[model samples]
Target: MSTILVTGGTGTLGRLVTERLRAGGHEVRVLSRHAQPYAVDLRAGGPGLDAAVAGVDTIVHCASAPRGDEQAAAHLVAAARKAGVPHLLYISIVGVDAVPLGYYRSKLAVEKLVGESGLGWTIVRATQFHDLVVRLLDGLSKVPVLLLPAGVSDQPVEVSEVADRLVELAVGAPAGRVEDMGGPEVRTFPSLARAYLRATGKRRPLVGVRLAGKAYRGMRAGGHLTPEHAVGKGTFEEYLARRF
Candidate 1:
């Protein structure tokens, strides 16, 4: 069994990936900032990281801070190269290059870093997770009306399903920028907001306000969705029912 190190093992997708890898009989180590026994702060980049990356066969990098993702990826790439790690896998978001959001731009930078890092690597770009949609709705529900951006379409996939794909990539050879994974269906923000309202019995009014920006227009153009590869099984409604 290979010793696999997970960068964001405590996060939503990271935890799921760690579990799947462990179930498949691989020894997993988590790279964490808080040091929860299973992880160390690989984000800081020092002897701790050198120690952690040493002898690890594969590195599944899922830990990403919106502002620090690029730096973190650079750190990982350097460490992976120094350690002579075999494979490095990254979980990215769909439309990262198309979307003009700052975070998305950072993600694109990291993509470049990993690609040129001189290690065998694979990148799995997945659609937004159901949990993110729900979390956004939950915050908006606190207000009298749920406010949403106009022309934005979301395809929310189950995190565990994405974890499955990442694990599959982990076990297989690197396949740089493979087919994107998306939710079973795509829906507008107002549509999903209404579904959440009904599910949670939050009788809030749904409002779709138009915004002026290239990013907003890009989202409205469905830059974040890949309908052709809607391979996720769980629907937003199903997730709402189960979660709320």
Candidate 2:
């Protein structure tokens, strides 16, 4: 079995990937800011990383900062190269190029760094996760009413499915910019929120407000969902049924 190093091993997606890798009989190591049994922060250079990458064959980069921070990607790439890791896999979001959001921009910048690093790499851009749907609803519920920023369509995929795909990518050869992975169906913000509310048995009023900008308009025009690559098996309704 190969030794795989996962960045952000404690996160929602990273944890699942680590579990799957372990289940498949691979030696798993995690990179975190805090010192764990097999942890090293990429931002802090030197032997800490050397110890982490000592015998690892693959590096799955799942760590990310807030939406606007582009420098983190450069740091990660530099560390991986310095460590002489053979294979690198980067997890990114879908619609990063189509949408003009700060997070998407940051992701795109990272993609560039990975490409130029001269490392054998694969970049998998996935849709918003099922957990993100719940987070969005919770955020809206905090306010008296749920206000959607006028436009934006999302095809949220199950986190488990995304994790599975990442694992597959990790095991296989480098496929630069692989096909986009998304949920089974395309949905609007208001509709998704209402469905989520109904699933959770929460009685919250949802209000859709149009914002004056091309970014907002792009969302409303269904810019986020990928019609050609809707490969995920879990539907929004299926996800809710399992949870609620």
Top candidate when judged by lDDT against the true structure? 1
The global C-alpha lDDT for each of the candidates, from Candidate 1 onward, is: 0.88, 0.82
Candidate 1 residues 1-244, lDDT tens each?
8899999888999999999999999999888886555455555677778778899888999998867888778878898899999999998999998889999999888999989888999988999999999999889889887889877889999988999999989988888889999999999898999899899887987788999988888898899899999999989998888987
Q: Candidate 1 — which residues are off by over 4 angstroms?
A: 36-39
Candidate 2 per-residue C-alpha lDDT over 71-157 given as tens digits, one digit per residue, 9 for 90 to 100: 656666677787787888999888778778777778888888898888899999888898888887888888677787655678899
- Candidate 1 global TM-score: 0.97
- Model 2 TM: 0.92
Clashes of each: 1, 3
Name the lDDT value of residue 197 in candidate 1.
88
lDDT of 1 at 106: 91
List TM-scores for all candidates, in order: 0.97, 0.92
